[model samples]
Target: MGQAAPSKDEVARRLADIGPGEEREIGEGVFMTMHRLQAIQPLGDGWHRAQSTEGSFSVELPLPFNDFRVRAQATDNVEMRTHTVGGKTPGLLAWSASCLARRDGKLGPEARAPGSDKIEVKGTPPVAHSRSVDLDDMTCILIVEAQGSDPVPPEADRLRFLHSLKRTGRPAW
Candidate 1:
């Protein structure tokens, strides 16, 4: 049988083991290949969560090479973001090209924001590259997005979810 892909828990462990400004290779030739990951940490009010990560990766194969940073929050649910900065050239064409190259799985149509950007998913398998966001500052493009995903223990509704789970010693499911 083929080698099994690394699990997110394994990824989290590797990430947590890394120092704030360190990097690790979770997967080769993949987005996780050239990464230097920090731990998945808590933002605020969320106690169960340990940390979040911020780092970049590069692909130097196929046709268009790209360099981008990845940020993600992993709990019972996983949420992530990618910002591409270098590659072919500047302008929408480059952004689109990189974004297209970095398509993971499509965001559920129902959840897609009104003006979510279009991406191409042909180059790598599911999530080959990272998404690109156009910004003017250039210095602060890796801003974190809001988190609203339904976690396993259901951190979304933290008050009841956290309280009940702690007492019951069971997931809110």
Candidate 2:
């Protein structure tokens, strides 16, 4: 027999209690780790920095903020890391992106141009902005979705979030 899944409240509780550098196993072969920024500078009022150590990138988000390094191991040595923030906060947008590194550490394909799309949700139409940055050995694909309200987030907010994304360096793992 298998164990019952956690309730929504329980899941929320766990996520709320997670602190910097703490890691939790949310699924089989998938791990989530909260990150701590080495240095935090004030971008503005009511915003915080979210960094992914494994992905080696950082972005800024509004208050009531947190970021997680989600690792899904496919095999003994193959894994992918996705960095995310603000998925559960009402009235606030969410950001989910991933960085992929070539094992050979060579320059890959040219980075794609930044673009935007409209996604239909239950209550409103969310806007999705996507961009890619090519590093020495990796490509970071960033996609941020603004939704959960009629007007969605302001265009300035979306641009700020997207423009704040920075590649710290190559992935550590």
* TM-score of decoy 2: 0.60
- Alpha-carbon shift of residue 60 in model 1 (angstroms): 32
lDDT of 2 by residue, 1-173 (tens): 54676677766666666778898876556577887533344567866676765667777765444555777643335455666543324654555556665343443333333332232233335466666665555556666665555244676766776677777876776
Q: What lDDT, from 0 to 1, does candidate 2 have?
A: 0.59
- Give the candidate number with the greatest lDDT: 2
**After superposition, which runs of candidate 2 have C-alpha atoms over 4 Å from their true positions?**
1-16, 36-41, 45-49, 75-77, 85-89, 100-126
Residue 149's C-alpha lDDT in candidate 2? 54
How many angstroms is residue 116 displaced in model 2 relative to the true structure, after the best TM-score fit?
A: 15
- The sequence of per-residue lDDT tens digits that candidate 1 reaches over residues 1-173 is 53575798976666554543344655432333222222222334432231111222221111133333443332323333443322222222221112211122323223333233222233322222223332211111111111133111222332231121111111110
TM for candidate 1 is 0.25
Which predicted model would earn the best TM-score?
Answer: 2
Candidates' C-alpha lDDT:
0.28, 0.59
